[model samples]
Target: MTLSSKLSAARAGLFRSLGLMFIAGFGATVAFDAWGQIVSPALGFANLSPHGLAKSLLGAYGLPNSDFAGYFVHFYLVGLIGYPLGWLFVFRPVWGRVVRRGGWLLGAAAYGFGLWILAIGGITALAGLPFFLNFTGITWVALVGHVLYGVVLVAVMRAFGGR
Candidate 1:
């Protein structure tokens, strides 16, 4: 192919990958929120409010502590962009290299577990909360929710022909 044609194809592939990531991320985030906010509460579990953590973080930084701000940060910034990009650029690639014969599901699960550590262990500390939320029930719930997020993310990506 000509140089210009190769560059055009590369650009197209980049956009396609990004589009897949965005859609998969949005879907996985919905699954995570549904479990944490709706299903868990109905099943007599604590209703997780991840946005609350975002609100606290915002307030700590002298930003507005409104629900809108919290939800925007949690859903849009982290869910749609951060986590998906992590999977696309970091976890998936590393897993592919480290475990050549490993299944994608397991890799995705591991990624989810890492996300839990990042959020519960790391982000909570940044927000001035106990690491892993002091290992409370909500901590386990968040773990499950994050794992579900990863599974759903990869599943959606695969369903749409992503590697």
Candidate 2:
């Protein structure tokens, strides 16, 4: 192909990949939220408030802590971009290299577990909360939610013909 044509093809591929990532991320986040906010609560588990945590973290840094800011950070930054990018660029690639078999589901679950660690172990501390929320019921709920997020993310990507 000519140089211009090659560049155009590359650009198209990039956009496609990005679109897939966003879709997958959104789906996974929605599942995580549904379980944390709705199903888990109905089952007598603690409800997750990731946005609230986001607000607290922002306020701790003297930034805007409005509901809008929290939702935007939780849904747009982390859900639509951060997690998906991490899956596409980091976890998926690394998992493929490490497993070399039909173990994407397990790899995705492990990724979710890592995300839980990041949130409970890292983010909570940053937000000035007791580390791991003192290992309360919410911590365990969040663990399941994060794992569901990972599984749903990979499933969505796979459905959309992505790795």
Please name the candidate that would achieve the greatest lDDT relative to the true structure: 2
Off by over 4 Å in 2: none
lDDT scores in order: 0.93, 0.94
TM-score of each: 0.96, 0.96
| Residue pairs in candidate 1 whose N, alpha carbon or C atoms collide under 3 angstroms | none
- Residue-level lDDT tens digits of model 1 in 36-120: 9999889988789999999988888899989999999999999999999999999999999999887989998999999999999
Error of 1 at 93 (Å): 0.7
lDDT of 2 by residue, 1-80 (tens): 89999999999999999999999999999999999999999999999999998998999999999999999999999999
Error of 2 at 65 (Å): 0.8
Candidate 1: regions farther than 4 A off: none
> Candidate 2 — worst ten consecutive residues by lDDT sum?
95-104
TM-score of 2: 0.96
